[model samples]
Target chain A: MILQGADALIECLKQEGVEVVFGYPGGAVLTLYDALYNSQFPHVLTKHEQGAVHAADGYARVTGKVGVCIATSGPGATNLITGIATAYMDSVPLVAITGQVGVSLIGKDSFQEADICGITTPISKHNYLVKRAQDLPRVIKEAFYIARTGRPGPVVIDIAKDVFAATMDYEYPTEVSLRGYKPLFAGDEEVLRVCLEELRQAKKPLLFVGGGATISNMAPEIRKFVNATGIPVISSLMGLGVVPGDSSEHLGMVGMHGTYAANMATVECDLLLGVGVRFDDRVTGSVEHFAANAKILHFDIDPAEINKNVCATIKVVGDLAWSLPLFNKLVKDFAPDIKEQTASWREQTAIWKQDKPMTYKSREGVIMPQQVIAKLNELAEDAIVVTDVGQHQMWTAQFFNFRQARAFVTSGGLGTMGYGLPAAIGAQIGLPDKKVIVFCGDGGIMMNCQELATAADNGFPVKVIVMNNQVLGMVSQWQRLFYGERYSHTSLKGRTDYVKLAEAMGVTGFKAEHPGELEDILKKALATSGPVLVEVALPSDEDVMPMVPPGGCLDKMILGEC
Target chain B: MKYTLAVLVENRPGVLTHISGLISRRAFNIESIAAGHSEEVDTTRITIDVEVDDELELEQVVHQLSKLVDVIKIVNLTRVDHIERELALIKVKASKVNRSDLVDIVEIFRAKIVDVNRETMVVELTGEASKIDALCEVLVDFGIIEIVRTGKIALSRGPIAAKEM
Candidate 1:
């Protein structure tokens, strides 16, 4: 069909099975917004461009689809920068469409002009500047394909204003054929055989899963492998939901603030089978001491990450979705009695789990952040939980019990604040039938609190639980331990009523200042038909426990309050 | 130790900035770099020379460069027997009396005098990096006015294509 670039973009989106877009319109994108008005595709107008991009990111994480977002040029494009980087770091599939000035005005510094393609080069999987209306269809096709392909990441397609108005005969490309871009899916048979032999012979073998496993949709395969071998599983923060929380063989999250048993198991294991995980600094406290006694078996789709941080004794570079099942098959065929081989190791790990459990002191009259997360977990077991970075994020990772794949979504690599509320909006929009909750800290909530209006306006029914500690909890903890406890600028001293703020944004609001009132307030907030916010006041000085200090080994963790 | 890496990347604008930005952001110094279109249809090959403390730093540089989306492949030329060359243009101060001597020096190095004037003479030399440095050292005595040198470009001495690997 012959159509203008803006109409063609909408056509391409429909062809790619995109049902909704999160965006904010501006002068540069006025024509596209006009096209959207007459089209059936729903575009949710977000309060901020950053919130739109983050909502897209959240949608992609939950639905496993390439989430789409649109914005104007210059500031609008720049506002999406943080969210784009967040998506890039976490390997989420997102396609950001930005409106640019006309081609003649691009480099001339015209009004509202910026070099977005250049700015996003390092952060995006790939980017394009559309100079012709004819190229829009092909670019859109390639953008979606690249965003959703191997090692999924964000891609940017900046369309010029004139191109949006120009006419073109559009035909969406059926397939993408880039000569230099091919992702490997199958693992080498020889490498799998070697890994199987190591698993069969090792006295103590542990399965370490990461976000890569979850991204590749290999949770079922991982669970099958773990069950067949009876190997204990430890997860990175992003890998939390790959193994059900109820599984006896699964250890809690392992990292800087990981559980005691998880960290100990990492140190004592003889063989570490890492799947779909880059050894981030948080996970491997000190590289020299991380898995020192283990022969590492690393499996990932990105070859650049194989030996980037930690070296693998036997590296298998392939998609986890394919390589994991192959490993399962090889184990079933070769090492049928793998459970007996690692029986003693499991017994030792059980002792570690029992000796040092995750514990926090219960103050008589004060509410605890851990208790709030625990209560939410109990009441909303099936809700998709999202969190912003900080003390509450770590607390959620520690206290909440995630039961299904893609049930927990948070900014892992970038650790960006203001991520929870918008991401919760995205999750709620993606899975409307499922409950969606955002566990945010006071510091993070204040960063993008404007998103509350976006949720209430759309009636998405997202529940926000704000752990309102009066200080920057994580940074305060670091200062108390490392610095002279000067507490420079970490204490947030102000009186901003969170419940009143929520009500002002047209959302129902509740507050709980005492431990006894939290449960009732939380239940009331969750039962609301529309968006709601529950602000629970927490102690100002509580620190996340089992923290591995900077440059310290996992074994040198601080177990309690310093 | 100094290492040379040949990085093949998609031919696109701002790709060079992406590569250089990554190196600079990591605080790694690039001694010299040269880039041009490769034999591939839409690929450009860039040769970068870096001086690092050890092999570990070199490995990290290679790994980080490979992380860029435009970067298709990268190979360290130090691991194989390779041929490297650099081109340089030196403009030297010249007088009537010293003109013959300057010509003699150029002849000895098999260098060509690309331009000449009453006050200055420009000599162009193309050879291995060491040869270019040697020529520069000899011409310095004649009060060299200015010099421009292309960074080192190298290829392995074999039939195998690095991109195919």
Candidate 2:
């Protein structure tokens, strides 16, 4: 059928099985908006472009699908920059579509014209500027394909305004033949054989999983491998949901604020199997000291990442989907009694966990941030918990026991604030039956507080819990610890009531001021249903403990209040 | 060690930007880079010169560049039997008295005078970078005014193309 470019884009979106697009209408995208209206496709008009993109990111994380968002040219496209970068850092699959100025006006600085393709080139896996109607189908197809392939990331597609009015014989392409874009899915068997041999011989073997494993849906494989090898598993912050929280073998997240067991195990282990991990500076406190004794085995889809940060003795450079299952299969087939080899090592790590468990002493009449998250964790079982970046983000990662894959979604790579509310709304939208809860700091929630209106309007039942500490908790903690207790400009003491703010935004509001009130109020908030906000008051001085000073080794952590 | 990489890529509008942008983004310094259409249809080959600290870092540069969606293939010409050349056009401050001497120096280097004017003459030399540098060193006596150089271009000495390699 012959159709305009915008209509053809709609057809392509349908063919890609896109359920919805989160975006706002603007001048440059008017023709596309008209096409959307004609098609009556499912669309979300977010409060802001940032909100829409983040919502798309959240939806993608929850649904394990390519999240699509749209915006017009210039500022609308620019606003999506932070969200795109956030998704890129986290390796989330997303496709952002933006309408551009007409073809002739492209370089002339016409109204709403911006070099979005160039702006997003670094952040996106790939980007394109489509000037012809005929290119719509292929571009859309390729964008989605690239976004969700090996080592998934965001892709941008900018459409010229004039092309939307141009007509074409629209047929969605069934296959993409990009010569440079094939995703590698296999690793060298010889390398795997050597890695397995090392694992079999090592007395102290540690399995460190990261976001890559989760992205590849390697949770089951990780579980089977850990069970077979008896290698105690540690995780990066992004690897939270990849291992079930209740497992005895799974040590908690390892990083600057990692648990004592995970950190010590990392230091003491002789064979470190870093599966689908980047060995980020945050994870490896000091690169030279990180796994100093261990021969690192790296597994990832991107070959560039193998030696980018950490050197690997055994490089299984392929998709975790292929390599991990193979690892599990080999261990099951050949090393069925591999757990016997690491039994004593596992016991030693368990003693480390016992030495310094992640714990805090409660103060009289005070609502600690940890208490709020713990209460939420207790009450809101089977809910997707999302968090904005801050003390609350770390607290969520540290305290909340995430059992579901892709359940604990946050801006790990970019540490993006203002991510929670919209992402929670997006998750709720994607999985309507699943409960969605968002944890935000007072500073973070205010960054995108306008989204409360978006939530209330859409009536997405995402429980928003703002851990309202009167100051920027993490910043003040850093200043107090590292600097000479000079708080600087971290205080957010301005008079703004979150409960009133929630009510004003047309959502039900609740507040829990004291420790005794937290669990009951949390229960009520969870039951209130339609986009409720529960502001839990917290003291400002409480710091995320067990922090490794910047560039300090994992062993040199500032444990507890000291 | 410095390496010359012949990167074959799809002749797309922003493919060059993708390659060069990525190199810059990764903080990898490119000594010199030149791009042109290759023998293959709709394919462009880029000759890039880069120096790295070790073999691992060199591998990283190659693997990172290869990650770009428009890059079809990358061949390390320095690793294989390759013919490398750099073309430089040097416009020397020429005088009637020194013109014969400058011509003598040019002849010794087997360089050609591509352009000439009353006061200046442009000498074109195609050779290895060291050879071009040597010629410039000799012509320095005539007071070299300005010079333009095509960074470097290379081809492996084999029947197989870079894409095949």
Candidate 3:
């Protein structure tokens, strides 16, 4: 019944169903490492605390479960800040545990002692500093709950050294009671009625979906509403795959890199039905100019999100699962002729789609990124594709035809650079049966390339596809587009041999220089088992087209042909 | 303007450090902050009045606060229609010279004398933050020695609750 503090912590983690944790042990958390020596639970030791946290975040995002990370206090804990903030921005569930100084030495600022709890407070969903060993079990239980429930986010638990050494009879609590925290799931009916009335009266209605809708798995209902009412669906960067991009009613992604038709539709529509989206700046542009003509009807589970950015003419604070059904029933009852209005909208959208066709050219003797993406789609149709932030991310978005919810998880809001590999590892760990492929740029991959070791050690069969261009391709592309081609801080010099690096990390390495070699290398990476890295050298000049330059309108996008 | 913010966080260690660290890291000036748990859940309500340019900075602070691990929710109750309350125990000189004026001022503010000695009068008062400030300013003339004020705590007016609304 009684155990060492470190053993108790590990036991608590095992009870919470934590199969894998990403972390690096140091002086402050040495006891935990000692306990883990004889422990059964697996931990992926990352090169950096940042990588550890990110790997956990990736795991959380893909699995819809709480991702766990651990680090010693001081610099080790501080390094996790960026990763934790990244999770917080995108609403990923993560639980980060840090070792702290003894309770007696807490205020004295002893060696390796940092106020990690205070440092992580604003960035975490909730945090705890356990001074007494008796509090560890309850805090750990609460941390998991707080991290995973009601708009999931990262929760940090910083344990004092004394607590880790102290002995206590540990038992996990079944229920937690937090007076200050109680998030509402269902929306009010009166608000829903008002929203329905507005939808019924409107001629042109736009269904703007966000990541929240995808997370909630309300895409089926969203499709029903769009089909029944004939409203065109436009999604945010994070909202991709909520409404299938291939669907006739889908407007593709809206915002900076959005389709011309999607942006135009957002403006021309009379009623804007925003569902499960935060209306981020990249999507809205200037808040005053955004959806200027529309009377907005916002439906979200978070009440605070309503009127937070753009004001909603009729706000329905509830889950889309409930709201969409009611709206569908009301529209069917009130406007039987809604089909006629939708038909015209769909026809107009068709014309707009035809006008701006996404195209790319394959320079002879070189592997193009678009061609690689299209090839992966053909070969691995059902495989999960994850991408880091860069030109490759945009190219993947434009090329990949996603069919499932939670399939396209990227650091959209934060636009974190070193996101892909760890995210793919997380995705693979979360869905072990499913094939997880990470599409990362050379620059992005090298940022957190050390995670390759994490994947290799865990035996997680994650395929890392590196689109090597020998530069910070996205920023360079932006400079080419907007800054007169004077590339600054975008060039990545002395590119490391990715294959050798992969091999060193104890993973299978496959390299492709030509288009002909890509498919074989990709297949090799998929078949090799455990973790594999496939490096494909892309043409340096190739740019992610159909990009709306920053601070520019959607109409001003630079299409490849145009 | 320097504003006092009363935030309620979980009653766990590192919460205050988290709050103060966030303020310093964001380069925001914190005039004063005081925190402790309420009578309800193991929640530590912190009252921090920060001096910033406009409401935008405050809103940014609130957003940043919401992002924190331990911070559950934030309400700028100042803009909302609500009842604000603060408890301050002040030890003031109750000399014969300014005793009558102090008593008159205390009567108007509906304050109670909690402690009394030959040289000191510990006055306890509960009211809106600004009212307390005005009373404190008035009592400053009587040579106030020690002041312990429990920061602002608020409750929404009418049936429009934070959850239901």
Candidate 4:
């Protein structure tokens, strides 16, 4: 059957089970917007291209689906660069469709033309520049496949504007047969058995989980393994919520601002079982000293990750879906009771956890950021918490009690600022029944503040909490500690009012200047029907404690005030 | 240490960009790269030589390259019995008087003078990059003009293609 190119693209999206897309339309994508007018799937019109891409990324993280977004060529497509790089770093499954100039004018620097495919090449898993209308279905199919497969990432499909109006015999491909793009599901069982043997022989073992475990949804498997073996678990920042933080055996985050027990145990353990984690620099400070005494057993779906940063003594190079279940079976069949053998080690770690738990002092009538998060943890035990990068982000990671998988979403690998507002909106859209709360600092919130308009326009029930410290909290702390207290440009005091800003964007706004007012404002905000912003005043001199001091040993942390 | 990797990739537009882009993005030090269509109908063979400090780094480069969707296979030719060669075209400044001497030097190195003018001559050599370097080293006294080389390409000594392996 004959179809318009735009209709064919819409049909392709439907076949891929895409329920919605976020985008800002322009001249290049005029035909696509017209066709989308009649499609069953909804299209969200964001205030900016960056907001749209971030929304798509947040949607993907929570729903475990390939989030789709669209933009026009030139500046419109360029605006999506930061969001694309963010998705790439975090390995989010996304498909960004950018409308391009007509094929005849492609390289002539035509109006609204840009080489988006080339620009996104390094960041994207794969990208395509479709010059002909006939190639849409196949490329779209392959794009979605690549984005959602093993070690999922973003893929870009830049289509020519003329192709959208061109007629074609449209049909979506049922199967993708790329010779090079096969997702690994199973791996050598023999090596997995070797890993199990290593686990059995160790006196002290630690399970280090990362984003991969969460991305693969290995919560049940991890839970069973830890439960059966009584192994203490530590998590990377991105791995938060894969296992409930309340689990007695699970330590808090283990990195620069790692929990005392997790960092110390990493150095003293006889064996370290790394599940679905890359030894990122932020997690492995001073790689020479990281796990120096441990025989590492690395399990991941991507072979490239093994020995990429820290060498492993044994590796099970396969998806956790494959290796975790197999390892659990081996544990059930042949594992010995290790709880008695490592009782002393576990006791030491528990002592470390209890003795130096994350804490901050409260001043008279002043609200501390950690208290705000702790209150939320108690009030909204199951809320999906999102955050931008800063002191507020670390406070969220440290204080929040995540009981569910996909419950905490943030820009982990990229450490992107201005990610909270739009991402919270997308999370709310993906899970309408669940409460979505976002935290950002005064410095980061204004970077993409325009997204508040989108949230209000759609009537999305996302709670945005601004930790209104008068200065850039994290950088100022670094300056105070390391850079001779030259605050420089960090001060954000006496700036525009967040409440008025939120109200101007057509959303309800609230502010809590004192500690007593926080609980009331939080309750009112979360109970409200649509999007609401609450700015909680915080002392500017606060710091994320136990910072490992960049490039220093993880165990040699600078314990400030805490 | 320098390692040679023979990679088989899908014969599609932007596959080379994907391969080279990855190498540069990861900050892998690439010694040289050469690519062309292979025996297969829809495959391109790319040979990359990379310098790394350890075996682990080499493994990382290979694993990362294999992750590219267009890259079907990668074989570390440094580990196997392989035939390696490179083609180079060298230009040398010569007068009519010492042109015969230049010819004699080219003959000894198994190079041929592919082009000649009144002032300079172009020498064509197809052998290991080391062999071409030797020829150039010998001809330095003759005032060599310029040289261009297609970095090393290699293949195993059996019937199996790299992709099949």
Question: Using DockQ as the measure, which candidate wins?
Answer: 4
**For residues B19-113, what per-residue lDDT tens digits would candidate 1 score against the true structure?**
88788877788889999988987999999999998876787798778767678899988898898988899999999989999999999999999
Candidate 2 per-residue lDDT, tens place, B46-129, comes to 999999999999999999998899998899999899999999999998888888888888899999998888999999999999
Tell me the deviation in Å of residue A462 in model 4.
0.6
Interface DockQ per candidate: 0.45, 0.83, 0.24, 0.86
Off by over 4 Å in 1: A333-336, B26-29, B50-69, B72-81, B156-165
Give the whole-model CA lDDT for all candidates, comma-separated: 0.90, 0.90, 0.80, 0.91
Candidate 3 Cα errors over 4 Å, as ranges? A321-336, A362-364, A560-562, B1-165
For model 3 the local lDDT of residue A561 reads 53
Q: After superposition, how far is residue A368 of candidate 4 from its true place, in Å?
A: 0.7
Q: List the residue pairs that clash in candidate 4.
A: none
Clashing pairs in 2: none
| 10 residues in a row with least lDDT, candidate 3 chain B | B156-165
What is the lDDT, from 0 to 100, of the residue A140 in candidate 3?
A: 89
TM-scores, all models, native as reference: 0.96, 0.99, 0.84, 0.99
Off by over 4 Å in 4: A334-336
Q: List chain B TM-scores, each candidate.
A: 0.95, 0.97, 0.77, 0.97
